[model samples]
Target: MKPTEEDNKIINNRRDFIKTTAIAAAAFMIVPRHVLGRGFVAPSDRLSIAGIGVGGKGKSDIAMFAKSGRADISFLCDVDTRRAAESVKAFPKAKYYKDWREMLDKEHKNFDAVSVSTPDHNHAVQCLGAMQLGKHVFVQKPMAHDIYEARIMTQAAEKYKVVTQMGNQGASNDGTRILKEWYEAGLIGDVHTVHAWTDRPVWPQGISWSINKANVPNELDWDLWLGTAPYKEYVNKLVPFNWRGWWDYGTGALGDMGCHLLEAPFSVLNLKYAKDVQCSVGSVYVDEFQRGYFPESCPPSSHVTLTFPKTEKTNGDIAVHWMDGGIQPVRPAELGDKEIFGDGGSGTLFTGTKGKMMCDTYGLNPRLIPLSKNENLNVTQKYKRVIDGADGHYKQWVDACIAGYGKQELSSPFEIAGPLTEALLIANLAIRGYDLKIDELGEDVYPGRSAKLLWDNDSMRITNFDEVNQFVKREYREGWKSITL
Candidate 1:
């Protein structure tokens, strides 16, 4: 068969065009998505999501996003083979990867957003990588394991101009807004102190890490699971859950619930970084005669107090007390003896000049003192409610990402979640400081005990106690780097 002369010319011209544009075409394959923002993706159209740590909470998070009907789960990554099974089944067509680094490197263009539900230690790096690719991100709380990580995440969110949200469902609830309205209206005038408590570390804490190395589970990638954390044997019970008690992995009870409970105060009072922190923690019994102090594990019980300087909403400094491991403040005299406190699981109480108010976990079941007061409470509706409250959190972020950066208000953006997380991690500095032991003579002595550690929020360090600053920005394991701007 012979081609016409005109067809032959056209084919040669097309081949030359391909040769000239190939380099640019390859580079454009990984171009920053933010450069293709609103005009590139219609706000009313669907979104694609890539999920890391797709099991347990990760599984539910992606499910919620998919349920929004506006988002498609396009990728799933998890180190544990078994944990990832359900998500892989649910999104069978979505590509699966055991290593998130591999997943992002190869398929960053396939998704419009990333949902990070990995361990606390890995959140910063994973989320930062996604943002570097210009993908909107939704990260689980506490946003990061260390103060530096949280700060970096917040700054990254803004720098990248990507829509971001922390997985604190309460932020989308009506209670926080209602509380904010009440506070702004002076119903609870000038809140001076807040007490937030949770019963957590339901997993073991205040114990020694198992020196005994166990065989790595067949379904788990132990090294990948460790991520930025230092190497350790894969203990039997640490997977699926129980990692929360270890300092290397989780942020203890405060990290688990502080964002949920303390978010109300942060929002209501417009609070940011803490001025100083101090704490006391319960001891563990290694034996009948010896007290077990495991520096690697979070204490069994702890009470941390963080002081925040005055914001526009208040006249003076605000003191927040965080109690965990089932330790709770003395019940308010106003609460009836038979009445359950904070729905019995966890609660936060705000003490103001005029009166007190409280709410259960997730900022749900908000109540004013005497309970009856809530029945007749009236304040003008101020904040717009999410279309469906907490469940709408995912949809809110998805819609905002499509709408482009700064186009919509988000309930738990990293800008807000970061400082909230810092306060908790700062409190952790005091909490972990309690475990700092030094040798005195022949006996062990504690220097960080009962110390009121001053915080230079700008520097993100403990001015009075340098030892605790070691945790402000933890050292990552070899072969890993902390995510930065």
Candidate 2:
């Protein structure tokens, strides 16, 4: 209807508002190609990253990624405010959250990749969830809590077509590559046996969970920190450290150090899954009257042996020994009385028919055992070196993610890390098996001591011992199930 000037002005204003709103909505619907996802990011732009578990190792990992000069730390998530304070200070602009699930659900599209330096148990679920969302991932060592999870994460990386790397930065070190080259040169000959040892379980081990519960700290969300781990009363000193000794929270000493100490052997020997595994663990004599065995706690000491079928590089079957809790093999004759063994505290020794070779933690300072040979021999370097060596590990991954999956090579891609981690966890199965205690006819009996656990790799089971198979894929607590690929 024909109206006065004031009514006409009101109608025109309403029409302008609708037109502007529609235009803005349309522009939003047409997302910037870079904002679509990392898959479409411009090669020139910095890759965005979101870090879960940004405390302890997670803190250092994110710092390295930021230092790479090609990545952006866009988000930080951690369960404990006290532990997370440093990261929050470091990335003041990035949003923070207590639960990783909430962070990812709300901001999955904002970051191109995720760094998981959480405990061993949560690694699988976090990695799988990120991969499911088509995000690249870098997880800390001892890839997963169980054998099955390692296998699943390995497969998920390939299936999702996402760039992935395990946090075994040593895999990027020159030592592993140099050792490989030496082995290939036939100087060490075919490695028939390997001995990797660590003085871990430095935190308390060989004990039971405290029956007396302690007050949960106000700065921590006890339930969220417990994530996939089963519900339990909080114990003082358990968070941020001693949890490594508990089965529900950690994979024990092997999980803590195996990835670092055993990586070189896996790289040099071209090893895969073990054909069989057996172990003998030392008992903690808490009291002179009775030796204590805490099923929930990792043993104070252990010696595990795993036999691997010969690979293309090996002449025959090879046996690998893993010792933790301060146990180490007899000193090699090539090492002088005063010469420190495997860099003193922890080391890897590869015994060969021709000679012995050794290196310290993370495969650093690799050397031929005779000392003189290490000083005299010259071998051509055939492998590419990371820009900053060990520090390059983080950059290598960030660069790979930016370059997109399958476009660049990585040091510890799942293909290599998966089998390597599986080997460590398989050895752990024997360690966990060593703790088995069953009550038979009102008397205690140990079933794991029966015989060597025969492993059928295809089936992922101990063919002979049924009891140990339960550990192959542990049961997750309700509502904390693993993510599907």
Candidate 3:
């Protein structure tokens, strides 16, 4: 896709700003070292971050960046004042705004980077808007709400020449590197099947939207909160949380936990976009005789299977099973009956030609099945460990932003996070497809439930099932902009 006229203007403005900043830096560099005060850091050496969604996880994200001591929280934006109260108090000097568009419009020149921890639906637009202004971005995962958005965000990161990091902090964990080393060492041979399960939905799902509308909270800007999503009347208790169960604003269990659970497999197996997907979801009944049909809400539970083309590390195709809503795969026979499966709550299991291995969420506590194998296992540490593992994830991005694009390696840059997120969203297509209804001879039938969806990654579409294609790239609310290349 070609850049729009507005895009060209933004690009040109960013280039001019860079040129001006470079000249200023050059002049400053010529000053004598003796003239400067002791312990003075150059303005260019520190990263100024503008945070969007500065509350809840957003609040913590910015806090971690501030903790790096290299990042200055210069601006904060959140639609809900109540949710943002803690962050606002924490960063008293940071400029605050309810609308992110206004913050970026007026203050883009002041910040060196942007941190986005908004709802899944708003991630792509916020991140892209920052990148267009030549600002590096650290966005929460899944990187985008839909597959198409993920692709665009990944491409935009490179096109704009900005450092990017997805908020899958687990990517920086030592466990991921350990798994990669073990896989490369042929300890588990060739992994052919993988199962990742999560006990999620901890929020409501498989339900209908409330019929009664509630008064909008005094502290929240409802419209801004719904950016990129269709406008809806205010519903009780939907702000601080609960949006995860709805399709319009969240990507359900996959968006919430898939990145954390799947990052290790992606890193170890060199997995990219999925080739095909199929799924079976648990159903809810409205009554004893009738099943509930609430398409807007994600199912209570789902087991999705995604197939990937063979990679260099794999002998053939690979099947990845994703289970959510407390459903889990059968425990491997290698595991003793008394042994806990996947940290008890949620975990990932890898089945290989030679053996099986497993890890808890965030890829922690990885071990070969039978427990005994891990005792004597010794694999050379090939990948350098992050300074503080998961805790370092925020600092890694902060440091990289200060170092400039392409100067440092990130654990979950858009190139990696995009494809990983896309694969997860594609699996969601099957889950959503399961509920698609078609009228045949006046009787409703779900053809999508029985068909395996074929994916054409290049086109970002489901080749066989057209109904689900609507979700590949969702339509934003009338005034909200859609992501463009």
Which one wins by lDDT: 1 or 3?
3
lDDT of candidate 2 over 50-98, digit per residue (tens): 9999989999999999988788899999989999899999999999988
Distance from true location, Cα of 1 in model 3, Å: 67
lDDT of 1 by residue, 1-485 (tens): 89999999999999999987997897676566578774453333778999999999999999999888778899999999899999999999899899999999999878899999998999999999999999999999998999999999899999999999999998999989888888888887889999999888698888778764578889998899999999988776888788998999999998998999999999999999889889999998878998888999999999999999999999999999999888989999998989889979688899999999998888887889988788867789999988888899889998998788999999999989999999999889998899898788988888899999999878878888898889989889999987789
Q: Which pairs clash in model 3?
A: none
RMSD of each candidate?
Answer: 6.3, 6.3, 9.7
Give the best candidate by TM-score: 3
Model 1 ranges with Cα > 4 A deviation: 1-44, 211-213
Q: Which residue pairs clash within candidate 2?
A: none
Question: Can you write out model 3's per-residue Cα lDDT over 1-485, one digit (the tens) per residue?
Answer: 99999999999999999999999998788665457877555666789999999989999999999988788999999999999999999999999999999999999999999999999999999999999999999999899999889999999999999999999999999998998998899988899999999999898889888754689999999888899999888888887788988999999999999999999999999999889999999989888999887899999999999999999889999999999999999878888989999889899898998888889999899898889999978889999999988889999998888888999999999999999999999999999999998999999999888678999999999999999999999999999878896
- TM, every model: 0.90, 0.90, 0.92
Task: Kindly give the stretch of ten consecutive residues in candidate 3 with the minimal lDDT sum.
Answer: 32-41
Ranking by lDDT: 3, 1, 2
- Clashing residue pair totals per candidate (backbone < 3 A): 0, 0, 0
